[model samples]
Target: MAASGRRTGRPTLEEVAARAGVGRGTVSRVINGSPRVSEQARTAVQRAVAELGYVPNRAARALAGSRTDAVALVIPETEARLFTEPYFLDIVRGVSGELAEADKQLLLTLIRDDKERQRFEQYLAAQRVDGVLLVSVHRDDPLPDRVRMLGLPAVLNGRRSEAEPVAFVDSDNVGAGRSAVAHLAGRGRRRIATVTGP
Candidate 1:
């Protein structure tokens, strides 16, 4: 793995496949969880990978599967509130447990303003993350568009619209809202009111 040409500019799996005398699919299957490969093919692929000093890009691998080996959770919240937000904490815990079952890493980023978000976009564009899970997206945020434009696989947490169309994981916000109102009614809190806004 310690080669001169591998100076941060990693070779593609195609290079490994070429060296191994296998198709890209075979290489991919080997990288993934496929056990259908022959012993000879497996040895060849492994040797070629070792010889070429190839590294698979996580972002590319993320696209091939529904879940990635690494996911960046973008929090567009104040650092103060990020710690206090109980729901965010619960979501993070669940995400951590689920990802640990698959042996993945979690990257956390907190962006509170435009300047920081712009800088964060550059980091995201560098392909350091396999997938992104953006949280607390506001209506006028530019970052969602930035993530979408990069063609990276992304899943927004708590916010998405069909018109914009993004993969996301969210609690039943509307249902919870209704439940809150019902609870208030059950308590006999007459002249009740609720405020809803983005």
Candidate 2:
């Protein structure tokens, strides 16, 4: 057989297969974590892969109908608040933890102004990210409606209203509000007030 030339000093799939003493298809199955591969073959392929430092080409994977394996954590707030606020930091940590387990990349984008918000919407509409995780969305924001209309996979940290159409994950704000009022009333306070945000 003819010797394959090294291209750019990166190990290729064919080379891994040769080193593992298996066919290219077997190597592919092992790399892709297919259950059909046998234990012995899988071990050999893994050893060869590690020895050669083989890294799969993500661009090629995308061309083969695979997702970009990336998600966007969209925070509709200023950069200063995103860093200063403990709430945003907790959300970031949670999202990062889940994405790390799934081996997907996270793209954090902050929308401080209308221009940047519009640009992000256009980017999402282009399907650049596999999904979106929107945080700190208010009642008046049109982003949830746009995401639903575009048929992109999205999850919100909060809902706009009780009848919100999109999927969201939020705490029981109403329950907390009621509990606060009850506590105040129990403390013999005749005057109680609540503040809300847009």
CA lDDT of each prediction against the hidden true structure: 0.80, 0.87
* Cα distance off (Å), candidate 1, residue 196: 7.1
TM-score of each: 0.60, 0.79
Off-target runs (Cα >4 Å) in candidate 2 are: 1-8, 174-198
Tens digits of per-residue lDDT for model 1 on 150-176? 888888875656566777777887899
Clashes of each: 0, 0
The model with the greatest TM-score is 2
Q: Kindly list the per-residue Cα lDDT of model 2 for residues 1-198, writing each as its tens digit.
A: 235654567798998999999999999888777899999999999999999999987766666655778899999898899999899999899999999899888999988878988898899888778888899988898887887787888999988888989999989878998999899889988799888875
Clashing pairs in 1: none
